[model samples]
Target: MISSFSNNVYKMHQRTQIMRTTTFIKRRFSSAHITLKDSNYITREFEEISIPVPWGHLKGKWYGTRNVRPILGLHGWQDNAGSYDTLAPLLPNHLGFLSMDLPGHGHSSWLPLGISYHSIDYVSLLLRVMDYFQWDKISMICHSMSSINGFVFSALFPEKVDMMVGLDVLKPLARSSEKIVDNYKNCMNNIILHENRIISSEPPSYDWDELVDRLYYGSKKSVEREACKFLLKRAIRPSKDYPQKYYFARDSRLKTTYFYSFSKEVPIEMARYINCPYVFIKALQAPYYESRQHFDKTLDIMKQNPHFEYYEVEGTHHVHLNDPIKVAPIINSFIHKWRPS
Candidate 1:
């Protein structure tokens, strides 16, 4: 918000935690042991998985032993599951890690036409995933857009969440009524335009260097140049029309997401409902997207929870992926205290 394929060999493209007590429910999960990045623990394995939904299916990457209830990982808007590539391995052994591309974001199928993507829809989608796994209580690791989803989900159903860790974002952003109205209008217009383009046009394809450049600069250089490869793994597909060029496979409609901006009072009120063991890491350089007062107010309310931990780290919005070593220790601390394996 994030793969292994190199630009030199572009042919191959590829591809959480929790407090819910010691309930060990195992599914028929396929397990593989592969060495992850510079992980602090011994080798942790990963496998590619596809979870069925009514429309189509959602694809994901599962790391470590799948027999244990894994901490579900959610990436930022536009990013795929590979966003956790570096950070997953750094987690505690036996804790397990699972991350999936939200529909229209990675290998997951896009919503059928006529359904516009809303940030709040993810709350229901999270429920679908939980039912799929038949999980009783869940732990989460969310970044950016998904982080806000976690905030809303936790507020809506506080008892279902055992623990949560949000990176760089905490709630649905606040905006003036006029600004929200303008954005809503723009989103409606853009949805129709994006739909027409998708039905009638082929997306522009880019060379490998250009893809990396776009990802690096497009995120305002938040994702390091080298770190760009992890996201590119599941992001690009070799173009059928043009050799040596690739196109982004995700649904373009995600770019114009219709976030239902709430007033600051709503999120502050929502914060009071989150009683789970929570950790929020704020990247100092990231934009607030609104007034700092709005963020501070919500945070102050969340701080009232004794189990809630907050840290301000020096990095960009994608700090979890860019410099995971700095982020992992904070997470590890929360895990050992709340839901140790």
Candidate 2:
């Protein structure tokens, strides 16, 4: 039955979210604007696509038309492109939105055996994507873990990215020296363990409802029952050994991804290089993954950029998924101001 306090929390959000969603629907057209193309290629209209990488292909969903350069949408850790299912359609149709399954997530091919997924490699992957599209500049729209990636990428390649929008994160949390050492040790050990499982183990299968329950509790009730379906759509596949059962499609080794964190001073320096039009939305109810002191100091540096905009909204970590109404307006307005056609 998967009953727990977390499930109770999910029930609470569900009760509240229905009202919030209805309000959004009532004003959807006015908020989205009539200027949006009549035949917008978003959400249900999205095209399934794949981008070639060295090892294999990175699969994705392309929202909107192919003619114009699109914003690159990156999701959180362990989440696939479906993380944007609710938010993508709310975006203005002036440009496309390409939500790619980062390596090892969703339908994307996992990295070759033994090559641990590193944070910097995703930056390289973004560059490869740019090269494939032959675009001179990029506009990034990211959430959770990828928010940190966007921050680092914008800071490192200031001139290459035209704009960036991050949801609920600024950068990787600063770790204590001891924490860092322990994490490194644990990361290596986990990597070896997962590698062994990949070769010698068959993943356990769950029924569809059970899959939903796992996602609901797995996200600590941040993703409610209704919202779990979006992520699960891309996260699971039919099991070969079990009739009418499924297994998670993502790479198990991804649970041990080596996050590239820095000392406080480095992120401050990095923040200064981000000169593009940037928007960062903080979920007030979300945990501050790092020291607020570290976040505040780094944020102070970023605020110096003339184009930076920041706001906080009431919701949990997956607010963009669970209650997109609160965030869609900010994103639409930002896009209108910064990326006007």
Per-model C-alpha lDDT, please? 0.81, 0.80
Give candidate 2's whole-model lDDT.
0.80
Tell me, what's the RMSD of every candidate? 8.0, 6.8
Clashing pairs in 2: 41-64
TM-score (C-alpha, index-matched) for candidate 2? 0.88
Model 2: runs farther than 4 Å from truth?
1-43
Name the weakest run of 10 consecutive residues (lDDT summed) in model 1: 18-27
Report the C-alpha lDDT of model 1 over 311-331, residue by residue, as the tens digit. 876678997876665577678
- Local error of candidate 1 at 268, Å? 1.0
lDDT of 2 at 67: 92
Give me the candidate number with maximum lDDT.
1
